[model samples]
Every structure is written in C-alpha cells, then in structure tokens.
Target: MDPKKIFTTILIWLPSVIITLFFIPNALDKILHSSEMNKIVSNNAILIITGIFLLIATALFLYNRTIVIGTILLASYMTLIVFIHMYKGKSYEVAILIVMATIFAAYIRSPFTFQQKRNY
Candidate 1:
C-alpha cells in the first residue's frame, strides 16, 4: 500500500466532511433565505445546477467513491459561491475560498485516492 496516498485520502476526507456538514449548510441557508440569492438562483439555471451538484458531491464524498469527481464539482460550486459573495460585498469570501482550496488540494494529493490499488 502506498502510505502517501492513504494520508492524502485522510486529508481530502477531512475537508470533505467539514464542508459537507458545515459550509454547505451555511451556504444553502443564504441561498435559500436571501432575496439576492433567490434572484441569482432563480434566473440562472447554472446556480441550480451547481446546487444539485453539492448534494451529489456530498454523497460521493461520503461513500468514498468517485471522490475526484465530487471534488471537482465542489470546487466549481465553491468558486461560484466565492464570487457570489464578493458580488454581494461580502469581504470574507476570498478567505473562505482560499481555505477551501487548501483543503481540496490536500485531498487531491492524498494517497488514498488510489482506491483500486491493492497492497502488494
């Protein structure tokens, strides 16, 4: 077994879990309650698409399958989220984006990514 990838998997899952449990909910709340968010999502199907993606991403991450795909989806949604916040004049969006990127990078580099590989 490649110990490095195993470590990487842990790193990836850590954020995946946090974002799924914490950040995602907060984001969804804003997207749901704020009139501004409703407009962004109401007119643009892209936002809704990404919203659905968050659910898919969480599911994939939880099952530890198709994680890279899940991460890619998450990255896209978060990127959009950051920009949305910035457009709304939220100053902390960039910081959140950076932290999320860092966590994602760790997962992308984790050893556990090689789920099909066996210990030899």
Candidate 2:
C-alpha cells in the first residue's frame, strides 16, 4: 500500500471512528436511562427518541452511501445539544467539539460535496 494512501485513509477514518465511538455510548445511555436523562431533557419520550435518532444518524454516517446525510444529522444534533447546554448554564465545549469532529470527518470523507461546482 502506498504511504500516501495510508495517510489519507487515516485522515478520513480516524475522526469518523472517534465520532462514532463518542455518540454510540451516549445514545445507549439515553435509551437505557431515560429517567436519568430527564434531568437534562425534561421528557423521557424525547430522550428515547433522540437516542434512536442518534443511533440512526451514526448508522447512516458509517454507511458510504448515506454519509452526508448522517453527518448533517449528527452535527445538527450536537449543535442543538450545545445550545441546550448553554441555555442551562453548563459548559458546552464537549458538544461543540463533537459537532466539529462530525463536520471534520464528513469533510474529509467527501471534500467535493462541500465545494460549489463551477462551469468554466
């Protein structure tokens, strides 16, 4: 394997894997501990739904065909969480980091999707 190919692969996948690892456990926690999550979200149903959404987004992110949509979903979700944390007077750095990671991974995966095409 070419060294350049290996480097590109790591650049593309490392952030994706990190973001996946970060969200999966949080999703499971929300689903399994809705009562605990109620302190943060105020509604158990919404918490579970968010968890399901996260799981779906993560799955989409891992799928090559649906990665763009998944990245959008994950970034939106984390952005919402960031606002919630700010509104509640909590530190939102981690949520912001997650959002950044999600976007970074997606950008690395599909750089062209983010660029406007020009007909010369």
Candidate 3:
C-alpha cells in the first residue's frame, strides 16, 4: 500500500477505534444499569434504546460497505448529544470531538469530486 493511503487509513480508523472503545463500554453500561450512566439517562428504556442505536451506528461505521451511512448516523447521533448537553448546560467537548472525527472520516472516505484532478 502507498504510504499516503496507509496514513489515510490510519486517520480514518484511529477515530473509529476510539469511538468504538468509548461507545461500546458506554452502551454496555447503559444496558447493565450502571449508576453512572443512569445519572445521565434516568429511564432504563431510553438508555437501552440509545445504547442499541449507538452499537448499530458503530457497527455501520466499522464496515466499509456502509461507511457513508454509518458516518451519517454517527453525525446525527452526535448532533443530538450535543444539543442535549447544551440544553442541560453540560460540557459537550467530547461530543464535538466525535462529530469532527466522523466528519473527517467521511471526508477521507469520499472527498469532493471537484477537488480532484480531471482528465480531458
């Protein structure tokens, strides 16, 4: 593989790995009724649902065939999280990182065609 491509892959996958590590454990916490997670989402049902969505979104993100859709899903989820944090006056710093990571990954996967060199 080209060095540039390797670097690009790393850039894409690094964020993905970080996100997976974060969300999987968080989802598990919600599923297992961890007190820490419960503080953020009081209702078990809502927490479980959100966890499931996170898992599915993460799965979609990890698979190359669904990268675009996964990025979209992740972005949407992050946006919701940002708004929730803003509403509650909580720091949304992590959410912002995830959002930027998703956007960067998506761009690396499919950059703008207009920015590419064209053949006559």
Candidate 4:
C-alpha cells in the first residue's frame, strides 16, 4: 500500500469511526436504559426509537453503499441535538462538531455525490 493511499484511507474512515464510537454507546444506553434517559426527555418510547434509528444510521454509515444516507441521518440527528442544547442554554459545540465530521467523512468517502458538473 502506498503512503498516500494509507493517508487517504485514514482521512476517509477516521472521522466516521470516531463518530460511530461516540454514538454507539449512547444508542445502546438509550435502548437499554430508557428509564434513566426519560429524565432528560419525557418519553421512554422516543428514546428507544431514537436509539434504534441511531443504530440503523450508524450501520448504514459503516457500509460503503449507504454512506450518503447515513451521513444525512446522523447530521440531521446532530442538528436537532444542537437546537435542543441551545434551547437549554447548554454548549452545543460537540454536536456541531459531529455534524461537520459526518459530512466531511461522507464527502471523502464518496466525492462524486457532492461534485457538481458544469454545463459549460
């Protein structure tokens, strides 16, 4: 493997891995301990559902074929989290960072999805 290839592979996958690491535990916690999570949100069902959604999104993200959809779902999730944190007067920096990382990773993984062809 060439050094450039190694570097590009790392750049493309590292962010996604980091984001997955961050979310998987949270998702499991929500699903397994929805009772505790209910203190933050009123509905336990919503927490469990969100956890399942996170798991599905993360799975999609890890697979090359569905990376775009996963990126969109994860970014959307993080955007909602950002808003919730803002409404509560909490720092939303981490959620914002996750959204940026998700998009960056997706772009690197599939540049064609983001490229716009010029008619000229």
- Which ten residues in a row are the worst by lDDT in model 3? 106-115
Candidate closer to the true structure by lDDT (higher is better), 1 or 4? 4
Clashing pairs in 4: none
lDDT of 4: 0.88
What TM-score does prediction 1 earn?
Answer: 0.53
Show where candidate 3 strays beyond 4 Å: 1-12, 34-36, 39-41, 110-120
Write model 1 residue lDDT over 1-120, tens digit each, in one string. 899999866875666566677546744654464445654556545544555666666566555556666666666666766777779887766657655763565465454774587789
Q: What TM-score should be assigned to candidate 2?
A: 0.87
Off by over 4 Å in 4: 1-7, 38-40, 117-120
- What TM-score fits each model? 0.53, 0.87, 0.74, 0.87
Q: What is the lDDT of residue 114 in candidate 4?
A: 79
| Native-referenced Cα lDDT, model 2 | 0.90
Candidate 1: misplaced stretches above 4 Å? 1-14, 23-39, 43-50, 98-102, 105-109, 112-120
Q: Please give the lDDT score at residue 55 for candidate 2.
A: 99
- Decide which is better by lDDT, 1 or 3: 3
Candidate 3 root-mean-square deviation in Å: 3.9
Clashing residue pairs found in predicted model 3 = none
Best by lDDT: 2
lDDT for model 1, on a 0 to 1 scale?
Answer: 0.61
